[model samples]
Every structure is written in C-alpha cells, then in structure tokens.
Target: MPYTRPARPPPEEASLQGSELAHEIVDVLVDRQAEDVVLLDMTSLSVFADYFVIATVDNPRQARAVVDAVEAHVLADGRSRPKVEGAADSSWILVDLGEGIFVHVFTEDSRAFYNLEGLWNRAQEVVRVQ
Candidate 1:
C-alpha cells in the first residue's frame, strides 16, 4: 500500500492546544523504529516548549531518516516548519517545533553522554515506549 499523510487540522483552529502535538510526535518516532522513546512534560519546569520528545536511533543514517520523517509529518499537520539543529552526521539533532514542543533525536552513545532526562529530571514523564 502507498503511504499517505495524515489529514491537516482545520484551517480555523489556531494551533495545537497542549500536548497534542507531542503525542503525535511520539507516534511518528515509534513508526520509524526509534527506541526508548520518552516524552517529557516541561510545562511547569521550563519556559521553553511545553513538552519534549526524546528518542534514540541506531546510527547517523537512521538519525537522518528519523529527522526527515518528523519534518514531513509536522509540515503535513499544518504547523510551521520546525527549526532543525545539528547535521545528519552529528550524534544529536534537535527539532524545534514551534508552540512549545522540542524533539531530541540521539544515537545511543550520544544519548548517554547528554543525559537530557537527568538534566530535566524535574519534568514529568508523560510517556515511555521501550
């Protein structure tokens, strides 16, 4: 079967209200075979995005694929194109999906080095996909 994008949200609706986009991102990452996906609720702890979705990939190639897939999904949802950081060769890539949602894609070694979950330990753990 041919792949298809999800329907765009209504034009009248201003934007994603809360953690709706974060949850959608969790599904996207999982679909692409991301491992140990963790969704953190940063609403009360941080002034940045309301939530953060972090996942680990196997390699740089997989990292690039995951980032591109996420970009496509976010654009298809009618949200502004995200501001992406880091190169495909980098160990970590950060995607800033506007409206207080940030995504961190990391390789196993990099994930361990950065320790985002520990740094943001105060944030609530919304979901964990093992």
Candidate 2:
C-alpha cells in the first residue's frame, strides 16, 4: 500500500497532549539509555515547533537504537509519525513530529558544536533527564 503522511493540524486544532507526548518521548529515550536528555518548550520561542527533545548517544549504533525506539513508541501511542532526516551514522539525526514535536539525536561532539541548548536558551527547560 502507498504510504501517506498525516496532515498537520492547525494550531487551534493541535493535539492537547503535546506535553504528555513529549514526556512519552523522554521515557522512550530513557528506556533506551540515552544520555543527557533535554526537553525544551518552544511554544513562545519558535513557530516551527512547540517542543524539542534532544539526546546524546556515544556512537552511531546507540543513536540508531534511540531513534528507532522513539519512532516505535510514538507510532504505537497513536501520534502522527515524524519525518526523519539524516542517517543513523550521521553526527545528527532529526525527527520532525508534526503538531509541534521534534526529536534530535546527536553525538557528544556534535551536540557541543551545534549547542542547540545555547541557541534555544530562551525556551523554558521543562525536563533534563541525566
């Protein structure tokens, strides 16, 4: 069967469970042993997404596992599937979950270089899973 992407709901029509969904994502990452998981509330800071989840893994294999686990959990929980970008081997991988959720997986060096935390410092830090 041909696959179809879910249409992004309007802001007013956005899922009310965005925060819960974000927590669910964090849970998945923690279960997968992701390091330094950070959740940022971007509701006021950005128009592109409402929440950003960042996590670091030591190697490409761990990165891949974290990505896969997150994807599986989101899908199984009845949320819209994200459009994944970048390969597992890449230093960074982004998963865009429409209706204001984005997941970023990066290597330690890549995380430092990009410094998403610093860039989004204005966004309130909701959770930091160490």
Candidate 3:
C-alpha cells in the first residue's frame, strides 16, 4: 500500500502494489473514452517505470476528462492523488502515479509524433483497449 514504484514502463500512473495499479489505470482510461489505450509491460525493458498506459485523446477536453477520471478513480481506490505533468492545454500529458506507474495521454498527432510505442517497441504489450 505504501508507494512502491515499478521498474519498467509508464510515465504518471500509480504503482500501488505494481501490476494491480497498472491494470486499474487501463480500466480508467477505457472508461473515459480514451483511444488506442495500451498497457505496456516494461518490467524487462525499462528502468524508470514498470508499466505504461498510453492513450490517445481527441482534444483538450477529452484529455482533461481522461486525466481527471484517472485521478478520481485512483483516489477513490484509497491511493493518494497521482502527480500530473503538462498543462491542461498541453498536447501531451503525463500522470505520475508514483512508484513507476505512468500514464501518457496525447493527442492523435502528438501520439504519432512522439511515437512511444515505436520507442519502446521491445516492451511487451500487455493489455490494449480500443
């Protein structure tokens, strides 16, 4: 229950007991209407985080909805509020759910431009929600 960061994929999603939090985040992203929601398992690939929940948003409003929904769900589940990176209008946003869980939210163009999936191509793709 104390923050223990996962050691692989992720940017700003919680690490509440590791994979459990990552999966929980995936659910939240889907519930909020995120597109191309992907849960990347970086346990064997990265060093900074354990899991990455990358999602695509349509606009700033959709981005806010995704981030807000993630925060609300995590808090309601008894974890502290996660740290969020980027402005409300940012093309890309990161939610740091401390301890190695990261959530990356980006606009379609931004998602394509950054190409995290391409960068971490070696990381195992765990759960992908449409």
Candidate 4:
C-alpha cells in the first residue's frame, strides 16, 4: 500500500485540555517496549507542537507496533487521530496528535541520524523511559 497520512484534527483543536496527556503518551511508549523514549516539552520552543514524544525502536516491526499503540491510546482519550507519516517504510513513523502532542517512532539508526532531541535542545526533557 502507498503511504497514507492519517486524518488530521481541525485547527481549533490545538490546545489540549489536560497537561497529563503527554505523560499518558509516554506510558504508552513504555508499555510497547520502545527504547530511549523521550518526551520533550516543545511548547516554549515551537508552535508546531506543544510536546514531542520521541521513541527509538530496534526495527521497522517494533516501530509499527509503537505507532499503533500510541494511536489507540490517543483515540481512547477522545483526541482526534493524528496525521501520520513514514509508516509505509516503518523506519520513522511520525504520529502528530493534532494539538498537544507529536510522536516520532524511529529505527535506532534513523533516530541517531535525525538527532531530533539535539535540534530541539531548548525544549526540556519531561520523560525518559528506558
């Protein structure tokens, strides 16, 4: 199948109600056994997203699992499904949780090459799951 972007929420849905949602996302990543899971507070750093949940997985299969887990939790939380990218290759899947969160599930090498955390050094690291 060709790469398809997940449905994006309306623009007005930018501000998530509770602050704990990001942590909930972190929990999902941890539960999926994602490695080096890091939640970065990007509110002050970027208007693009309030939080960036970056996770490193061992391979493409693990990446897909992490993405599925995240989408499930976000949906159960009453949030719109995110506009996802990179799922076809499953090397680096980005789950954009419309307002409050943006998740990045990357293969180990891809994560290192992108160095997302390094680029957003201004954002504070809120959660780190082994």
Best by lDDT: 1
lDDT of 2 by residue, 11-91 (tens): 555645788888889989989999999999999878788999999999888988899988898788776687899886888
TM-score comparison, 1 vs 2, better candidate: 2
Which regions of candidate 2 deviate over 4 angstroms?
1-15
Q: Which candidate number would show the highest TM-score if scored against the true structure?
A: 2
Global lDDT of each model? 0.89, 0.88, 0.88, 0.82
Q: Could you give candidate 1's per-residue lDDT for residues 1-130 as a string of tens digits? A: 9999767556334235547778999999999999999999987888766889999999988989999999999899887799999997988999998767899999999999999999999999999999
Clashes of each: 1, 0, 18, 0
Per-residue alpha-carbon lDDT of candidate 3 for residues 10-77, written as tens digits (9 for 90 to 100): 43333446788889889888888899999999888878888899999999789988999999988998
Model 2 TM-score (2 dp): 0.87
Query: What's the distance in Å from true for residue 27, model 1?
Result: 0.2
After TM-score superposition, the amount by which residue 54's alpha carbon in candidate 1 deviates from its true location, in angstroms, is 0.3
Clashing pairs in 2: none
Question: Which model, 2 or 4, shows the larger TM-score?
Answer: 2
Cα lDDT tens digits for candidate 4, 1-130: 8999877645545345424778888888899999899988887878678888898988988888888888888888777787888855668999878766788999989999999989998898988888
Root-mean-square deviation of candidate 3: 5.7
- lDDT ranking from best to worst? 1, 3, 2, 4
lDDT of 3: 0.88
Rank by TM-score, descending?
2, 1, 3, 4
Question: Which parts of model 3 are misplaced by more than 4 Å?
Answer: 1-16
The residue pairs found clashing in candidate 4 are: none
